[model samples]
Target: MIAFEPTEDQRLMQDAVAEFAKATLLPRTRELEHARGVSEDIRRTAHEMGLGLVSVPEAAGGQGQGLVTTVLIEEELGAADAAAAFGLAGPGAFGRAVIELGGPERAAELLAGFAEEGGWDRFGAVAWSEPAPCRTHEGFATKAERTDEGYRITGKKAFVGNAALADRFVVFAQVEPERGWGGIGAFVVRRDNAGIRVGERHKTLGLDAASFGEVVLEGAVVRDADRLLGDGGEEGFTRAALRFFVKHALVVAARAVGLSRFAFELAREHCDTRVAFGKPIGHFQAVAFTLADRAMDVETSRWLVWKAAAAWDAGQSERDALLASARAAAHAFEATMRTADDCVQLFGGSGFIRDLVAEKLMRDAKQLMLAAPTAEQLDQLASAIELGQKLDPALVLPTPDTQAIFT
Candidate 1:
């Protein structure tokens, strides 16, 4: 039931995206880096192409094209400019969070606005990470106290993507503090919410085209309807949340695959042209072997990502899907870093210069590794599932209680 070949329809879409990447993103990568965000025209183009809603369910005002297609498109985007993919206007992580945590019914109402007029200017984010762990509780520092009409959320969420741009957020908070990680709850908090405001943006080593900042909720209240109580309580909600993270990581891994591919190609081209001792550098044993290894890295990462994405699409068990995703993502993330590093190494002194893209690739690859759960964390998850151990909420997934990952 596992298929590596994309559908004919998928091939067409891939080609179209590839062309857009080459013509638009690749050329303007430096421009995006300087601008510190995706240009409005490019964001508008991506929106018109339905790039943001590709993986969303049809019932939730999306294409419902499934995860496999999503990874393919993501790879194309990453190959051109991984940073711009994050900067693209759309629900992004917020859409995936709602779909996993709230289901289609709630997502329909919350997500329908993304397709409206001027929707290209809209963005949504998942406020999952925190500035620091809650010292008193075993979960998030952010708390949600029950109120007459709803719950009032209060705390600071850091490393949140599109924080300043997102009008809507799926904010995670400590609901039943006594229950620890099990007490966590998710709420839909709008930017217009009286007590919610964006804080200072972080300047990172890479992915400058995307904004990562803090969301401070000093008693932001959400109505009862805003609660995304998946299947209802602790275990169910935790399971759904874990699934979302793994699937989201898989999507990020596909991008890593593309980054690896681009790096490998860039290195190989340099090796073929650059002469070291009278012949092309690629003819040397060391350089040739490195290129060969990176070639394997690209193909291996792509297949792993495809298999994991296909598992979800094919209705595999949650444990199976999670395990596959963890392995794929872990491998892809490391391979991307290695490939980019080698790409720089092959370029000698020139790679370090800003005039070349090698250094940027290296930095982007490193930053991307943190955009989701780390390879180390993912390996722990894979091992936990393999050993048949009870999946502890804190141990099996990245949480505010443990490592605060960028989402």
Candidate 2:
């Protein structure tokens, strides 16, 4: 049996984050969406409130919390503004990776700057995904060569979060050739480094307020001090130790569930108020049943998130079963997106209009799917676990012989 009861401290943190979201973040989301940028005031507020550095270690410069806490807080922010929600994902992921993978000197240096004295805010972004022949770390083509100074990296990474705004990037590059396992390594590259350029800005569907664009690195020089995980070794051991996939995915799942909850509440409110023919529309079984089903899915997924998060923190060794947890979360998120669309349809023209925020939530849910270790990937992992074999990192699924699995 799995349980998701929050401790007293966690409950307090959740309430505080929810209150802050309602009072400060939610109101400005619309304006920020139109502006496509977060103001310094908002950043400062988040920093002072300890929102920006929540997962970072207290030893260096963070709150020293775990995944469950991070997910809970992100849910409140995500419901208010998806761009802000998306913005935090990178910083949180990168912060953990740095703390776990970076050498002591490098970790200390980066974390201190992240603490942000007074009003100066510093955020970290990871340049992991790339286009063509290389979609993620498994198919990485970027390379870093050992030079007299340190390392010179040259590669193009697309869809790098906060590319335009971040002070430093945890650049992922291939360090070993053809021995075939140095898969990826992270190097801390500063914005002012020579040959490092922020490419075209993209106005994405939902996270338009957050900076989304490409990062081009041409012979970007990195000193030995900047080299984080892998340390010129195969397998990128340091990075793998960080376990970012589960951490980021759980927070993302929480946000999707939160948005769906908001949609459900709005739909219920609308059903009770709007009358069709004689009585309230909610009295109709067809409308009420669909709402009830969606509500159950949201709650179930939310609890599952909490369970997996707890397991991950406790260092539970359920490798074979963990993939299923990720799959369940993905299904829940997908269901929310579908249900939110239905909510829009139920509201008729009013839903389509810019008056209600349901349409935005639907769009936000769609955009969240862009984060990596996609649903298809999760399915592949499940397939591998079922087959009792180590899944090839590069295997694309539906497995060609899809019939074989069923037969």
Candidate 3:
């Protein structure tokens, strides 16, 4: 039989993070948004608590916890402030990319110094999404050419998380144009490189505390050793890359579940207190039913996310995990949006006001959906897996050819 309950250790960590989120994040959410970043004090506190390293391997200078634990903590953070959760300093998507694309051998070398003192100020990013797809090939417009010194990369990546702050980046580029999507390569690009520069930050609708911007690689160069060619066995690099994106999306999905929970709770609390027709609004049938529906939404999304996370930790088949992740992420994205929308509606005009967090949650829910592979993209992935179709990275993964999703 399978177990859905979190282990005692997992519960302890979850509770601790929940406490921090409520005390530190809940109150300063607007402050973080107005500042357009997480505060130094909060970052330091989160870092000290090992929030950034919970799912990383010990060899990578991290806590060696599983994805299950990571989601639990992420949910807590998302419940209080989803934007701040994204803004917290850490390797983040960059770490997940390296582990999957660069192989485990490089994790120790690439992930160093992310967990040490002053690490709160350090960050890493993945430059996956481009401003537009390549018209010539079914891949990124960014090109990386082989050079005697390594490779010369030229391109612009957009919608990158921590773009303005990260010094390290996993920049994906076209390696063999004829091979199309399969020819793509990922390289470790340093911000200080002579040819790389960060573009202006974007004015996003939500998740204001999280920075998203562009990175311009004007003939940037990297050594051959900097390239990440995963040992993907017979299935090759495409499968590995897909795995990376799927897992990354699950993390984002877990956060969506928390956002759903937060919105549902907020709406429920309002219904309990706000009186209408001579009693609490919740006493009415419509209000009570809506709350019940949202309650189910929260629970369903949580279980789906948990099962997907558990599949990864349990080392299930790649197909099984991929399907689970894709479905979970897609469902959570839609559920979060619905829950937030209903929350705002229940607020009866008060939700539109920034004084309450309903409007913010609604905005965040939409932004979070695009923050990863996206519900539409994930649905496609799940269909491909369930139908036993060929797993093409161009089709399943969140590529520029499909959609320029935020990383």
Model 3 clash pairs are: none
Candidate 3, superposed: residue stretches over 4 Å from native: 232-234
- lDDT scores of the candidates, listed in order: 0.90, 0.68, 0.91
Report the Cα RMSD per candidate: 1.2, 4.9, 1.2
User: How far does residue 232 in candidate 3 sit from its true spot (Å)?
Assistant: 4.4
Kindly provide the TM-score of model 1 when superposed on the true structure, using C-alpha atoms: 0.98
Question: Can you give the lDDT of residue 176 in candidate 1?
Answer: 91
- Across residues 162-205, which tens digit of lDDT does each residue of candidate 2 receive? 78777788887777655333355678898999869999876677
lDDT of 1 by residue, 1-407 (tens): 93369899888888888889889999999999999999999989988888888877777667888888999999999999888889999888999899999988888888888877687899999998898878897888899999997999999999999999999999999999898888889999999999899999988888899999999999998999999988776789988898888988988898888888889999999999998779999999999999999999999999999999999999999889999999999999999999999999999999889999999999999999989999988999999999998788778768765577888
lDDT of 3 by residue, 229-283 (tens): 8764425787888888888898898889999999999999999999987999998
Candidate 1 — which residues are off by over 4 angstroms?
1-3, 400-402
State how far residue 237 of model 1 sits from its true place (Å).
Answer: 0.6
Task: Give the local distance difference test score of model 2.
Answer: 0.68
Q: After superposition, how far is residue 338 of candidate 1 from its true place, in Å?
A: 0.6
Question: How do all the candidates rank in terms of lDDT, highest first?
Answer: 3, 1, 2
Clashing pairs in 2: none
